[model samples]
Target: MVYIRRSNTRVVTERNLDFKEEFQKKLSIIEDGLKTYLPHEDEKPEIIHQAMRYSVSSGGKRIRPILAMATYEMFDRDVKYILPVACAIEYIHTYSLIHDDLPAMDNDDFRRGKPTSHRVFGEAIAILAGDALLTHAFNVIYESALTYSERMKLYVLAGKEIAEACDSKGLVGGQVIDINSVSIIDTSEKLMDMDIRKTGCLIRASVVAGAIIGGAGSSDILYLNTFGEKLGLAFQVQDDILDYKENEIFPDKPTYTSILGIEGAREYVKKLSKDAIDSLNIFGDKAAFLRNLTMSLIDRKA
Candidate 1:
């Protein structure tokens, strides 16, 4: 049985309005950082650059980067130090989305209410754009780390965490399993293994990376890792529930709702959400923002 930490400290410590306002401020910062970091659309080899810019500029929750920044904030106040790595995580996420939407993959026509990279830029360019983002992210990480000569080692360790999370040991491995196991994903164990690796690893990496950059102690990092994993699973489960509600769930594909039923899935989301918030108890009131954010995710309408 998974241990769920219970705290007398409530999750709703902050007002909804304040939380939303703060979240938007962070979102705006992330948007600016992304634009700053990405290549200009008019750069030489214009098409790939444009495609890259287009996909990266496209709107999303920016949750991964925000998570990293928030985790860093728990220990350090100057989030600028974590900005490059945070944006790097978003680049990785965008690259995955671009590749996932290709004809060879999910064959999606749209993302974030806009045309997908392949749909707008054609398949070859989209593929190249994704590759560019993936490669560029590492450069950003490396170059940014050099700026902080004193904490260079921390940056290297954090970058390594990000790399492993997205490579064969994590996201890619899970994606391979997902693509191949449509028919074989019969048990919750198998399904969760895929979900944790595909989705949880990066989220976990984001939190852990932030903690590392912030100079967190090993035990603190361990707690944050658990928080990220629980939150990641809860986030995906909530997505499954929302997809079901919207009639967007593919019948042939296995999902939490399909495996556990809607009510069961809802209950699972609640449990995971609680566990995720509980994992933040070590932060006390300093974690109010993250705790509220965690609650908001499971309760989100969209």
Candidate 2:
């Protein structure tokens, strides 16, 4: 049970200068950690290396890896043991985003404010790039096992967890629901189920993987799992809010707001964000970053 003393001072407002500085600092650490942990190209595999680098370095919020590092730090664990797992989590996530943006999927032309993989690389290469990232994520975890014997077991377990989350039982299954539901007119319950498997699963894995790598006890891990589950739902709800906002800007864009109504969607996101913060109470102040990040998700415009 790791804990930090609660401050007597009020919660720092997001507009505070210190909050922006701390957020940027965390983002820098995450970016550097990702670059350091990514595979180095030798002379032999130029194309694969190029695709991997292109997909990963395209720039988005490195939220998954940052969450992993934050959880590891909360428990006073060595960052080294968690770095590989954090990188792997990001790889898996990036792969999903790549595939999600493909022609047969969401058919998006832009992601993270740039051309999507398929749009730039052709569909075949984009598919292969996603496949490579997915498989290479496992490779990273396996390679780490060779060096850290004591941490090897946890790494293996985290790898297995990731596999489960990315497979039919997790993200893919949720995606299947999302595709099928596109024309069906979504109900609240159906949307919840779809988002849980599609987006929530990986977010849940990100937090749990951090706990596993940090060697947290069963109780702590359980609490973290709960936290992740709630956070995951909150994240998707925030995405829904963003979708609605976009629809307002461009009336032609498809959006949840069209289906749920703006006020209803906003209320739903609010409820999810509250639930997410409530789950962090078990971790006390040790979960400060997680708590703040969850709130940030709810408040974000993009």
Candidate 3:
């Protein structure tokens, strides 16, 4: 199995300055892009609008949108053409977060250091907000596709895949399995399967959307999808590790680490990250930012 050892001896205290700087720069661009796409103040149903904005503006990594933008930049530098779709990806991600934090789901009271959507807004409004954002994401993609220079068939493909990835068979299904697993005796294989569906599906969609919009060929798309799959797995493993570590220090929820053990989870993340980076070798020098981003994902603290 592919694996890379952590360069930092202390996982909790370590910070890579270069990775942080690059992530922040990309995050700023993504934030600006999202702001440009948000509904204007005059839009109807002000509470729903406010909740949607509140959910998105809660300050996470913005990794999905950045992945879309960076993947697009790999083959094309025209940021203007891709910004709408990037924002759409962010909208979908934020919607998932909002739903995931509900009392019926993860029941998370805080997200990205702030009150979750359900905590600030009532659960009914939070649910409506998530639904609205998910639907609005499609609208953004359709409108943005109209502005493309060549009437891209690939954009159409990306749009279809994005819809598929967010549906019952994708992230939502994965979430269902995750919630069910909490009460049952979950196996390692089961957890991995659930993670790939829940988290890996969107991650795959982000990379594929970037490749499609960037005009990458079939081979490039396949390689990037492989990279994204591995990255998604690594991301989940890292989350497990963090969850386990946090539970040790303070009150927290359950995680794969609670099931798999901390060392095993860390090792799993290392293996996934290695495979993710290995997948990029197929692109030669064309995927430098993608490669760097994969490495940064493994090394990231938050």
Top model number, TM-score: 1
- Steric overlap count per candidate: 0, 0, 0
Give every collision pair in model 3.
none
lDDT of 2 at 169: 74
> Against the hidden reference, what TM-scores do the models get?
0.93, 0.88, 0.88
Off by over 4 Å in 1: 1-14, 245-250
For model 3, how does the per-residue alpha-carbon lDDT over 1-302 read when each residue is reduced to its tens digit?
A: 11223664454223344445666777888898787788853578788888888888888777888898888888898887678888899999999999999999989899888999999989999999999999999888888777674745767888998998988899998988877776653577777888888999999899889889888889889998898889988898887776565446322334667766788788888888878888888766666667767776777676
> How big is the positional error of residue 59 in model 3, measured in Å on the Cα after superposition?
0.7
lDDT of 1 by residue, 66-134 (tens): 999889889998878898999999999999989989989888998989999999989999999999999
List the global CA lDDT of all models: 0.88, 0.77, 0.81
Write out the backbone clash pairs for model 2: none
The positional error of residue 66 in candidate 3, measured at the CA in angstroms, is: 0.9
What 10-residue stretch in candidate 2 is worst by lDDT?
1-10
List the pairs of residues colliding in candidate 1.
Answer: none
